[model samples]
Target chain A: MTDPTALSCPAPAAETERVLLGHGSGGRLMAELLRDVIATELGTDPIAEDAAVVDTGTAEVVTSTDSFVVTPRFFPGGDIGSLAVHGTINDLAMRGARPVALTLAYIVEEGLPLDELRAITASAARAAATAGVPIVTGDTKVVQRGAADGVYVTTTGIGVRHPDATPSAAHGRPGDLVLLSGPIALHGTAILSARESLGFESEIASDSRPLHALVAAMLDAGGPDVHTLRDPTRGGLASALNELAETSSIGVDITEDAVPVPPLAAAACELLGLDPLHVANEGCLVAFVAPTAAEAVLHAMHTRPEGAGARVIGSLTDEHPGRVHMRTMLGGVRVVDMLVGEQLPRIC
Target chain B: MTDPTALSCPAPAAETERVLLGHGSGGRLMAELLRDVIATELGTDPIAEDAAVVDTGTAEVVTSTDSFVVTPRFFPGGDIGSLAVHGTINDLAMRGARPVALTLAYIVEEGLPLDELRAITASAARAAATAGVPIVTGDTKVVQRGAADGVYVTTTGIGVRHPDATPSAAHGRPGDLVLLSGPIALHGTAILSARESLGFESEIASDSRPLHALVAAMLDAGGPDVHTLRDPTRGGLASALNELAETSSIGVDITEDAVPVPPLAAAACELLGLDPLHVANEGCLVAFVAPTAAEAVLHAMHTRPEGAGARVIGSLTDEHPGRVHMRTMLGGVRVVDMLVGEQLPRIC
Candidate 1:
């Protein structure tokens, strides 16, 4: 007799008998994997937010974790070490939390140079110090050569939620204005350039940085009016906006001309047959704010170096719920769907 | 002209130019790598304890993170899923805390079976439910084939410390009684048997179980007198004892005859020419208790199923600080040193 309590997992489709690289691309396939497999068993919705907020009886705590597997380890602007710190920090910031401490665990492959490991750790430490968050504890494990890549870092962060902040993707309302924190695609373009040896001029560097301070400023300015905050990471801006739309049951109308895309990144994306909106951004955020507080939040964001290029690129609407539409520069409308599969694998 | 703030990293020695498989064995080589590379660059000691306790203003919070890369995924008793959950819970329990929440992250390799992934998630969820802790948040990433073995799960846990409990490795003092919660070597031998296809007659299952409930019982029986608690993992009892000695500046003298080693595990270890003392255990813990309260704690521990085989294995002394000696069954005293290199890789 089959146990009723045992989960009856469906077999993978013929096309997906085994996991493909696309399943980790933070795109449509990844979403399907989470919805069909992980979420059904774990009993929690995984796509709702970047961090989980838990009440610890005495105080509300927010926790976020990410694994860094970016190839090349070292890039034009930041190494894997710093990227690991900034990634989790940014996740906490998106939830309007003050990150307190972090735990780092490393899986190093056999035969990795000690000098390289030192450089990575030092860079990580410096990033933590700059963000004022100490790495309190850590674990190290080594795998045999050929069993693992050079190194993989997994970092988890603990933070205290801002008192007046209740930002969430589900909180976006029809009248909210969507804001872009800065230019997109720089981080992804830089990594791809380095990996492919594209020799692109202008030396586009990754915008890898911690965004907690900028988040603090916006929270201070908008208070409870900030409806949603998200970083356009793996699947990038299009994925983030579509997620917000689905979660809030609202429609997003973004103007292509209003989106901030650096000329270098835009050109690189065009040449590489990539969509800038679908390319990842390491140190940028997209915010949905009440129209009344949108101007003030944008002004506050502009005061910070990380958010100097902040702009209002879209607005939520009730016409087409759970969808995102882009107003092209040529005055035509187009649906902006989530990327279907892996575009750039191991790009943080 | 050296940059003042740049970390002064030493070059790798000729014989150790690259990381070896031994570096992740939780043995001597791992310690050297930590001391010479990781600790110096991160600017924090990584070997002091299992979990790092932090003051959260309202209450004390204990946090621990571990990356699980156990090969074969499934074993006789438990899978990597339950092991990941139990491992972090044990770390929290070692510090006398009540584990409240957990975060799970996965790094999967391409081509992994979806059925395997589903089984792992279901097992992990069941483990978390059994332990009364919720996996509150999670992240999943995929690496290309050969970049990762199959799947690596990293779990981070948060728990609230008991008000009356102040257990620490540094708190062990002379005359404290050393207690072993249960039999040793079962977990390591089970993994080895599965990995090497060794046809041992008895199925020595891995003793992977959550130890929080047992720990709570010990605390209740001997609050404020449970000097220290440590799970015998990775480098097993010998490494754990050496670490406690170094941290407490005390010596431990254990009686080999008094220690609990299941006959099946002993036979298997003997067959493989491995020391049961240095073999890893997942469910067992070693505790240092004040002499006056030792009997009460042991009695309390025995009442629990997980600790049914509890025994007084040793006592602390001031004779040789930072050393461990075992009174052999033949009435001869022998020194027990930490394992020098890889004994069993990815055991937990």
Candidate 2:
């Protein structure tokens, strides 16, 4: 995923010359690494969105890729396999694409149990099938026992762009209404609870499910009015909102009370000293819809099971370009800045 | 890449309950893992080729993926970066597809040198540009230091099938001719020498360049008559031939003297007690062309730099279906079987 924050942040210090865990935290450091190192070396303009569209002569093909190295492998609600499938699929959906196929790749440790690999593979297959896309091709490589974690999966998805939508992070504009599907922080909280053996395991579960169907419904209802669609993964809602604001050169104002947070996840975030706005969510979306079509889009979202909790949380503004502000319950407005570094790594 | 040997092997015993290094060795064990576990659980037919073609309603798109975990990260003639690009491109080329876009994904070990990451990214970019395919989209994830090696890369390539060709592993006929694009074993030997410090590093180099141009030339000359195309990567020539034979349900006959082996690679293989035919290759291809078009294809191959050492090495036969026989230099015939275990791990 592209990090628009790279355009606004100062150059990283020269002596911080090694890749830190923060570089993968979907924060300011990750954006700088991608912009200063990867993009510069590759001589390509920084990618500003989840998927890239390529003209295949006969049609435009949308492509995206992601690697899952979540610790513990077998987390509640989802494992690495389904995560791999759902992650890539959501990336395509963010681009308003209908995924046609996915390619799966695994980097396995030499001593991983056969049963573990089988279970992961089956989970990935079932997820793909349920999403109506096939795992058409794949690869598996084994490294020495100590050379890798149990297994890491990389899935690449190919899709056809939705004809009625042209959603992008840079498409947001003043007056566009922001609508969020479902709740925030469930995924990040579930992962943290599972990883640390926290007692809240039974109370929180990952929202790691596919969101393409919900996205499709939004596009069908709003057509070209669906200006932008984003999934709050990795850096979560705060980073995603910041990226959109910076990329679109627009400001966003949100009503804190309207942002839904599942009670369990909110409690877990509070107890863990984590910001719910900076936590990853797998099965939801943040959409910027033209105000004229907002009600229709929200209605369409409510028709889908994945989007039953959809509601308007904010609206784009022109007051503070490239900034996000929230109206607190205390009636004061506070700037919602992006996380400076990683609060959690490998949450995805 | 797919291994057709799964169609010929007997059922694996239930006692072998854990995954072995050989499961990713590009041999019989790997084939069984794919067929009996991955494929069976996924409810799909076993894949028997390098890439899969998905009809996009408007065009046929070929997709393939591979993850590189070579030890030492850098090796003679190529590093993990270049290997990743060349590997996926070669897979797409093997399917008569002209690559259009590529995706690069990285799983980095925390604390890896930023300089190393930059170098690898630059190398991958250069390779993709050389192949005329843009790295359109990508992803990066960081793991704890001990959770992974320095870095692993998974590249997925998307391409458009050639309008004039339809080459496939199962398209081989009894009278088809087998041609080797160049010498084998250089890649595997170079990696081994680099990894083990075997003193042959100066004398051996990996033939790890992209071969899509050479494949394009062959397709131009033979068109639809080019029955099949495969790059002898992980399992090398012997395994590739076995796969072709088994997939097409035909026998293959080879003259040992006709298969080209560079003097340095041959010496390295001998000193290391390895068979050149059983080692991996990255740049070369094995093209099965009809006898009537063999001369034209060979002539066209000679016009390309990567195919300068190309030669007719074998022919498909009907006598012993699903078997390969090599006539030795001394006039003795022997069965050339697939490698039962890994001769070299992480070779590509």
Candidate 3:
């Protein structure tokens, strides 16, 4: 039987900064958050689809687990529950493995309210189902009232890396073309303004979403050109791009006109004095494509529903190694520095 | 090049009721504050040493990664830098894998002092050297002032799991005897009391030593009968026991007389009004042994220099499934429930 307190989670009104565990509810935002930031940071590892198969045939697979404790688990479109699954699944994916199974673990505070937990569980189940991934195993424990905020989830995803893809964030190159599956900053702005404190509106919503399907689409479509794929998150666009640029010892240049920033987000950024490019986005991806296959890879990204907003935000350049630059809409150039801090703490 | 302010992370301590990102900074207490409580609440997942390999043979290998964000960076016995290495190494150890390489990623705040970061890096080097693990690859980025606390480290450990015995947290059984490696609460108490403001000390240093050696020794001595092994960290002894009870569908009865509480720790707890069992301990283990092999396991645990204080904390029983009972010194019995709330917020 479900604990009564575990299920009844309250919904804090938008813009309160008074986030509850429901935000990390693993509903939608969690997945979106993973899709946005962590995936970008991961670049590539072997990953499993919904579940990964460690084809050791007879060996019992070993798995490591983690939890997302970012505040404001619930943001514009998603929560923590879905984030947990995607995050785990993506971790397995980075290993270039097919995820075979996931073990879910949750730590809920005493007064979290049972309904909220049930909602999170339901969301987790739904996400796992959508990804065709099954939770398979789980454990739950309750912390005293003040010990935990609401709920924190840890998942261990076990998968078998594919033989063909030796993916890793460490393996980018100077000649690669940087491709973005979509826009930037929507996720961060959506959550920040949603709090009612920022009080800016452009119909901005969090881009928190799942990108396994898009990942699969990219892997299949771009294969060799898809040297590395990552989702820009916490430190947002600047951090993600900087990592890739530094790793490859390459310079990156993007056209501002080509990068998609929703009208609402652009306006919101000006009001809050935040750089839209530096804001976090959940569902977008940045890919390092082989220069020769850049066009084909862009086509593949555009083909996927998740990648419909696909565009070439930037490309590798040789002149300024380990540097990133952008052409402003004003037709002038600006040096895009790596993010020095998180724009929004625990937006994920 | 590191930023001039790369390590100068300082902000007047805030008097807020809720949490902030500093709690996740690897600087000091993030792990103790979060992982400790979370672990106590959830217990152990599986563990691997070296690399998480599973007969992948000469071709494929098992690898895992993690990030540590304990606040304070520097604490009584250790810092976030060393803790990160220990954590990654322990994770590999849990898989019975030998750690080969690590990728260290740092997100530093702009204007952080160079000396502080240099010290942290040196500590990381020291930790890696002590653990016999090397940092082969690394990535560093600077965030704007408020984007990051001071510095955060994310280390991805690559390891090969042990061959003979495949251990996991799921392996605990009904008749297993629970053994604690040594005195508890040292790590937790020392960190909290050592704070400048708290200014209370009983020469209670944190037990923040690495446990791979102890675990390695245990693996050599006990093998399979040591059904499950876990380091009872943030959540302390009570929470770990509760997890075992629930997972193994068994009851655990621990004699208060049998549990060791250091004299100073007792006094500190009395003053703090915190239970020693519920406090965090960075360096300790709770080993589950089969009834027939319990004595052998304890003998082996006590054999190690680190395990000199090893003791039989409890045993599994058929009644009160998933519940833990403790016999008080007064001969009264009480339920030892899971840790409910956060004991000390920024204690690692």
Per-candidate count of clashing residue pairs (backbone under 3 Å)? 0, 0, 128
The TM-score of candidate 2 is: 0.84
How much lDDT does each candidate structure score?
Answer: 0.80, 0.79, 0.62
Which window of 10 residues has the lowest lDDT sum in candidate 3 chain A?
Answer: A44-53
Kindly report which residue stretches of model 2 are placed more than 4 angstroms away from their true locations once superposed: A1-58, B1-58
Task: Give the DockQ-based CAPRI class for model 3.
Answer: incorrect
Query: Which residue pairs does candidate 2 place in steric collision?
Result: none
| Model 2 per-residue lDDT tens digits across residues B61-173 | 78888888887789989899899999998888888888877878878776676556667877887888888887766666767768888889999988777789978888889
Q: How do the residues B49-102 of candidate 3 rate in per-residue lDDT, one tens digit apiece?
A: 101323334323345444444556787678877776776666556555566655
Q: Candidate 1: which stretches are off by over 4 Å?
A: A1-58, B1-58
Among all windows of 10 consecutive residues in model 3 chain B, the one with the lowest summed lDDT is B42-51
For model 1, residues A1-27, the per-residue Cα lDDT tens digits are 888657677765554233333333223
Worst 10 residues of 2 chain B by lDDT: B47-56
lDDT of 1 at A294: 99
Two-chain DockQ for each candidate model: 0.11, 0.14, 0.09
Q: How far is A191's C-alpha from truth in model 1 (Å)? A: 0.8
Measured over all alpha carbons after superposition, the RMSD of each candidate to the real structure, in angstroms, is 18.0, 17.6, 11.4
Pairwise lDDT winner, candidates 2 and 3: 2
